[model samples]
Target: MGTLPVAKKKKAGRQKCSSKPVKLPDDASAEELARLARAVAHPARVRILRLLTDRETCICGEIVAELPLAQSTVSQHLKILKESGMIQGEI
Candidate 1:
């Protein structure tokens, strides 16, 4: 079966996200805001975070069982969320 390829990021210009809830500090960089917004943009990533947030822990293999995506793909997604500080794990 062919896996649905992840969409390439759109190279739109640095459009100001006026809808941002809280105004960021002056010291925050554009790249930092963009990265944070991107991390919470996916449904799968949101689900993973929600699961961990409630349970307080989960292994990579368990996530794979709950998601349609492959284990490696789920791990990659988890890594991104973890790196972005939206989630944490035992390991």
Candidate 2:
């Protein structure tokens, strides 16, 4: 009997995300503004934004190294920022 190929299982926990900026329709800006505001609402997110602004680019590991939070925490923050179009990267 031929063995069936097992489908690869996705790892649990924070999944990888692309930080590429997502463009929205012109009319969508107002709706997105609130989300963007919330994304930067946290101090940690603010610091992350500043770090990216100062450096112009950063890897997820680099951001995590600079912050006191755990890697998972940083990843979550990055995800929010990326989703809001505040920052872009592969994380």
Candidate 3:
């Protein structure tokens, strides 16, 4: 009998977006800053946004195909961008 490899489960814990929706310095809400930080945290995400910003339109699936990352990872990155108001999802 052949052995099958086991798949690891991913972590899906809750994260607090901000302490409160209080006014921020420079009119940048804490949430917005956090979101921007998340977007710029990863090099891949930077690349992803750069591609989308320069292209007429970018398909999420195409990004996964272009980058040497797992499809799910790329999707996560896309989700971050969408949440950050930096990009939109077409499908």
Candidate 4:
């Protein structure tokens, strides 16, 4: 009878998917797309943006009044949107 071939031992480590770094667009608009998407990731943020768009002017209190969320929560969502460059605050 012929002897069976022995199987080689497998290495126990996470395999790398790719060694090369992924290339992303250098344009401001391309970068902004991701930021804007993240900013509106929450339902509250989407609602806030929609409300703002419908009005000529708005305030934090106004936004809170329109939504079911608490003032602080609304403010937090607004802050995220602002920081992501999706909204502007008036003085």
Residue 22: error of model 2 in Å? Answer: 9.6
Off by over 4 Å in 2: 1-28
- Candidate 3 or 1, higher TM-score: 3
Please, what are the lDDT tens digits per residue for candidate 3 over residues 1-91? 1111111122332111111122225878788788678777999988875555455434455567778998779778766755665554222
Error of 3 at 30 (Å): 4.2
Looking at model 4, which ten-residue stretch has the lowest summed lDDT?
13-22
Using all chains and alpha carbons, the TM-scores for the candidates as numbered come to 0.58, 0.64, 0.60, 0.63
Task: Show where candidate 1 strays beyond 4 Å.
Answer: 1-30, 89-91
Report lDDT (Cα) of residue 66, candidate 4. 92
TM-score of 2: 0.64
Clashing pairs in 1: none
For all candidates in order, the CA lDDT equals 0.54, 0.61, 0.54, 0.56
Q: Rank the candidates by TM-score, best first.
A: 2, 4, 3, 1
Q: Write the per-residue lDDT of candidate 4 for residues 1-91, one digit (tens) a residue.
A: 1111111122332111111122234665866687767987999988876676565445566667899998878767866866765554421
Candidate 3, clashing residue pairs? none
Between candidates 3 and 4, the one scoring higher on TM-score is 4
lDDT for 24 (candidate 4): 30
Residues 12-58, candidate 2: write the lDDT tens digits.
Answer: 43232323334555677677778877997999988876666555234
Model 1 per-residue lDDT at 41: 94
Candidate order by lDDT, decreasing, is 2, 4, 3, 1
Residue 49 displacement (Å), model 3: 0.6
Q: On a 0 to 100 scale, what is the lDDT of residue 86 in model 1?
A: 52
lDDT of 4 at 44: 90
